[model samples]
Target: MNKVSMRFLMSMMLIVGGYAFAKAQSAQSLLKEVDSKVKSYKNIAIDFKYALSNEAQGVNQETKGNVVLKGDLYALNLLGTKQIFDGASIYTIVPEDEEVTISAVSDQDENAITPSKMLSFFNDGYIQKMDITQKVNGRTIQYVKLTPMDSNSEVKHTLLGIDTTTKHIYRLIIVQKNDTKITITVNSFKANQPMSANAFVFDESKYADYYINKI
Candidate 1:
């Protein structure tokens, strides 16, 4: 090769390398951007539709409902089924048996799906890998798959579908060790809205014939 040709090739390669470096964004930067967006809201409330499939339990349940969530309290309501927590107690209403199952706050299985516990997840994970882009939902998304580094945790893997437009968690899919899949899709949301204490408190004194099951 001629000296002139070799010089030109080296210059072209440097130019291309610089361009690529300038274009690529860092993983931390992408997660920081999403974090900034999420931080805009002090608290969150969303109306979601959820599907839970527990292969071990042989349970497949699809419940269309709105969940009102804040710190310590979360209330989930479907057309008929209702679940509420007043921070210390969890009350699940079973209309089929006409009773509300009241269980104390502990290491119960139902605590994993409680609204308060799940929302705390946003502050918990570090982005192992992140590629930011737009999805069919029209929100700018940081489509990330996470492995829970916490061994004592109930959730195994989490797939977050964040809304770029709203900059909030649009969809959260949680997979457990027992092959139980819980997917919560946020249809709409409001932040810092006034929710009654009664909203998280299940009052079933009115329903006399209902049966209560404690876990």
Candidate 2:
């Protein structure tokens, strides 16, 4: 190719490369900002709707849940079950079975999804790209897509929707390798809410009839 043609091609490539770099950097910065805003809250209470579906399998399910988070501690109520994390041990209470399972927290488990992880899990092991922005209910929501670095991961990718004005998470969509999709939509979010002193503490007295299985 002539010098002029080669130079034009190189210039085009440079522009495209620069744009990609800037887009990636913007996605990271926006996610970090959201994390900062979430961590600043003393406590947070969120009511959410969860939906899971697999079109190929004809499986569909929907549920509503709520969670209260304070630092690394969290209390989640879902499917008639309650899970509490006291920063050390995780207490999972199953009322239908009248049992409670206690286990140690394993931060090294990358596949585990907890309230804290939901906020900052994209910090590592993923390539983030700024996806799209949409207006819903008079608010602007910006989405970021994260593809796992591990090819063996069951999850194909995850999309996080953040409220641009409040920097709070609005939704999370997890697309699995098998084409199963799980979407969690935040119905309501309350930050810095006043929580009881023992919100994250599992009181056995409340479930006296339940079996306490400590592992």
Candidate 3:
């Protein structure tokens, strides 16, 4: 090619490369801001709608749940079950089965996104890229696409949507390798509210009739 054509090609490449770099930097910066905001809160309470669907399998389910988080502790209630993580152990209480299973938090899968880690799971083990933005309920939702770095991970990709005005997570969409999609949309988010002393504590005595299994 002539010198003029070569110069134009180089200029175009540089422009494209620079734009890509800036986009990545912007995404990382936004995520950092979100993390900082979350850390600033003493605690968080969230009510969300959960949906799981697989068109190929003809499976669809929807439910609602709520969770309260403080530091490494969290209390989650969903689908007639309540799970409490008390910084060290996890207690899963099933009302239908009338059973309570206790297990150490260390025994849980490291890659599993537990209730306590839902907001901050993207801090590692994933590649973050800025995705599309949309207006939801008069609020701006910015989506970040996360691709798992582990090739063997069951998750195909995840989209985390943050409300730009509040820097709070608005929605999470996870697509599994088996083509199942799970979506969680935040209906309400409250931070720094007064919590009861026993909010994160499990009272085994109250479940005297239920069988307790410790693992």
* Top candidate (lDDT): 3
Clashing pairs in 2: none
On residues 111-142, what C-alpha lDDT tens digit does candidate 3 reach at each position? 99889889999899899889999999899999
* TM-score, predicted candidate 1 vs. hidden true structure: 0.67
In candidate 1, stretches whose alpha carbon ends up further than 4 angstroms from where it belongs are 1-43, 52-62, 78-80, 109-113, 125-127, 131-134, 150-156, 176-180, 213-215
Candidate 2 lDDT over 1-215, as tens digits, reads 99999999999999999999999999999999998998898989999999999999999999999999888889999889999999899999998999999988863374756776877787889999999999999999999999999999999999999999999999999999999999999999998887899999989899889899988
When 2 and 3 are scored with lDDT, the better candidate is 3
lDDT of 1 by residue, 42-157 (tens): 55677888899987799988877887766667777776877788888888786766778788887576434456655545445433444345566455665656667767677677
TM-score of every model versus the real structure:
0.67, 0.94, 0.98
Candidate with better lDDT, 1 vs 2: 2
CA lDDT of each candidate? 0.69, 0.91, 0.94
Cα RMSDs, all models: 5.9, 1.5, 0.8
